[model samples]
Target: MIEGTDNVSREAAAEAAASSNAATILPGATIGILGGGQLGRMLANAGSAMGYRFVALDPTPDAPMGQVADQIVAAYNDRDAARELAARSDVITYEFENVDADVAAMLMSESYVPQGSELLYTTQHRLREKRAIEAAGVQVAPYSEISSVEELREAVERFGTPCVLKTATGGYDGKGQWVIRDSSESDEAFATLSKAGTQLVLEQFIDFAMEISVIAARSSKGEIKAFPPAENIHVENILHLSIVPARLEDSVLREAERLAIRLAEGLGVVGLIAVEMFVTRDGELYVNELAPRPHNSGHYTMEACRTSQFEQHVRAVCGLPLGDTALLSPVVMVNVLGQHVEPLLERLAVRDEAAERLNVAPKVHLYGKKDAVYKRKMGHVNVLAESTEAALDWINETKIWKV
Candidate 1:
């Protein structure tokens, strides 16, 4: 259950890009990366290491990804700049799934978009994603679309108590989603989104043991690799930690990987895909959702694995040989959210409570953004230990956050 290498037969790959011509995206080739966030920044860094030039597109100046790229295409004026990016780059890949699908639809006419835009289309909308997963023969949480209170009331009657109500679009990190304790709260749940004129997804609440994610990569040549399941914890809907080994039973872990690999191959997905999953109280697995790019759950690999997720993403998208996803160390990753991070540098400087308790090298990655607020993912720090328990303790007590 780890990232792929060149293992799958060529027949398993998409019909068109089966050849191994992907080895040299060539030094002079320019790679276009959509969305200039930290993930894009990391992808651009890996691209530069191979002598490839990069163009990062974003809507604002000083975007994290744009800082390191050869060409910075700011966000506004989507049509004009996208055509330009398609024209200049040999191939294009996106850092986030939220990019305008219409842009990809537009770009497909001119450039080679090996990562199918249809996957983007399906994943961008919650309804479409749930359908795709179900079509792949996977079980997803029971959900119904809601456009008004009347629809939501009917959904509550069908699905019943302890459900989550989420906006059908543009939501993450606990934003645009809420929990309705029972039928009594259905009215408020519906009113909340409906008053604001938002479409919604009312999903049955799951009584799961814990959350886990399998991060995998696939190349155009049908080669696939997967990273081990990462145990994930959330605080106020924001990701707090991702621990590897995931402390999962061998059987459950393998099943998670199987589901991920199946989804990747079934969707004809190219590049990295993170499949978020739920292990129910009965020891059964369920598909929760997906992210069509390198995920926060896989961040520990940068230092603990044989190959970084960023490198694998580039390889898969450009059709290069996949790298080994083997783990070199036990890792504990803590997300440093929002304003709490302003004091991180000072904490590390003091050798205070945080530094004194650590037993292994901790790799801290700051996204270089100055703003902070509750729930904003500003950066993450990873600590490696010999034992999973020890690793967890080190991460919990790191205190990289300021007062």
Candidate 2:
């Protein structure tokens, strides 16, 4: 990973020097957001509530994030757009990590891109991300680099079968990656990312008992706060569900938190850092990967927490102290994916809200997306229960999402 932000540090420090309040962003200040997705929309909502305006930069003007922001700049990576956005905003932050560092750097050079663009340079590339995680004293799966057929063959021979070959950069939601179950799948895996050339890593298959993620935020001043760990389930490489307070041993839970703080401190990272980890059958924690922004796993925090991650994100980027990261209720979040437009309650047959139902479930959050395709993130429902089993039952009944 990129060790230090030599050039980007000056801008981050300057932006940190400009703001220090945590409760709210100053009125009328425009906060420039890099990506125009649901995360950006939530940030815009929180900013508006705080009397702050927002300018969103995205290639797709129709993206959900821009719908709520004050102004939309219809350019994703255009340096010219970055200059214009930087000129109008008091500070800038990104909702997505895929924002071009050069473009982000351009904005920072001119005005402010709080949190700096250094983290993105490392996270946008998987190889650097793995390196960073390991450097922070975390154990990653056994892996090797692959740039050619010879390299792939070597990696396969060295790491053995059932290894996953993934793009070293720009792969997400099951994209730009492959799981090689046997030697039979090697040729196809090579053909898939042939266009990407040398940007690939061969990872060892873990006999993992569970997958967990830590969504933590770090202010530009180096103060850090992390949300409770959440367990995740994936189907076809896309997130299927997430349950907070994942059924883990106390020692393991403490270890997860320790690893998270170590990683944030090691990177000197600013803003939200979501570290995905694998817990082996032997009760060992292994670093799976890292996402340097509000992660999909933390989406449940929107309703389950005292302060949503989006709000905390702004606080961190603005150099404010993070709010209390406590869980008010035992929440289990279920994803409403695929092509079903049924309101989640109706879909789950949960109707009457008159006399306060005793066995009532949790809250639901639906992204305002029009089209609903298979595996598409239409929305999600958060179920608060007296026990995990009760919540799981409700989730199973509500699983009639788009097939």
Candidate 3:
């Protein structure tokens, strides 16, 4: 089990203590979700099985979560709709960090939002997120705030070539970022990104051995539990695969879990927080980013761990005891992007034959998305095996992804 820190601030400790005394929301309560994406769907599915009802708010009429839970088809900033959801729910939580911070703050003011808006506000913006991580006694890649092309060039000179420039807010899955491999590229990158009219941050790229994530769950009572580290691989900046029991030394993995729990305490998170970090060749861990909700890298936990992250999130927000996060198997979870959906469906149609040909049976999950646009996340497949290598080998043999 992962141990939490003793260094939390007095105010945070008091908040946790007070929250601990608050009423524990049992099953058969309504859970209000702020976003109606796949995470919301999965959370509803998990909570529904435990006898809880769910209401989701999203702009799309046919949002994925709408298929499983009661959905409010309205813009995230629609105050009336948010109010209606709050009135109908016993507690409110968001599935994604990009939800409007002001809306979250409004919900917190009038409803039972276990995961407060402060964490949401801090994480949605890259600059604030990095500073918060550093303030938590965790190290992040060296970075400088940039406001103009000149500042960008100066930062490039200071950090050297191969630095990254990213928008302060609103970008994910490889969007809203530019890699400046040479000083000459700074102006162009700046000019292109600055048009978005948002503040930018310049980060010194780290030459890390591997990227890993620790999904930590913290209840309002301050109880914390972290799942096993997941070694992640990305293709074009989008997560492609997450392998459990990250291929790192035990000591490093322990340090990563410790840091994650510490950060959760520092931020006063009441639900799941996925901490992405870079492990240097020298075994140093540097926090890369934070998601105050379920993360793509944590998809492996649905089938690999004793408790899925979805169920854990529900427990954390509803003031229930955190479930055991022990790893039950060595697993590899490969994403099925939009382009691969048809091929995956074809394979699924001949399940027995495909399993025989590949010599492995992978548990496939498809989000009920209507369209299959290129690069869009359609679903994922979890391959549990005696070894992660064997699972990865099966994924390769299938030739679904380049691996």
TM-score winner among the candidates?
Answer: 3
Worst 10 residues of 2 by lDDT: 351-360
Candidates in order have lDDT scores of 0.81, 0.78, 0.91
Model 2 per-residue lDDT tens digits across residues 1-403: 2359765677566545543432234667789888888788878887688677888888875677767775555666788777777887888888888888888877767876667777888888888888878876789998888878788887887777788999887778888888898877787898888777648888988989999998888887668888988999887787877887789997888888888888887786778889999998878999898888888889778777888888888888776678778877667777777554455546547553421333646676767666777668877777777666667766665455433
Per-residue lDDT over 1-403 for candidate 3, one digit per residue giving the tens place of the 0 to 100 score: 2246454455666775667675578999999999999999999998999999999999998899999999999999999999999999999999999899999999989999988899999998899999999988999999999998999989999999899999999889989999999999998999999988889999999999999999999987778999999999999888999998799999999999999999998888989999999999999999999999998899898888999999999999988999999999899999999999987887777645545654555999988999998999998999887788888888877788864
Instruction: Evaluate model 1: give its TM-score.
Output: 0.91
Model 2 / residue 35 / CA error / Å: 0.9
**Candidates sorted by lDDT, descending order?**
3, 1, 2
Model 1 poorest 10 in a row by lDDT: 1-10
**Clash statistics: count for each candidate:** 12, 0, 0
Give the residue spans of candidate 2 off by over 4 A: 1-27, 343-358, 399-403
TM-score of each: 0.91, 0.89, 0.96
Model 1, global lDDT: 0.81
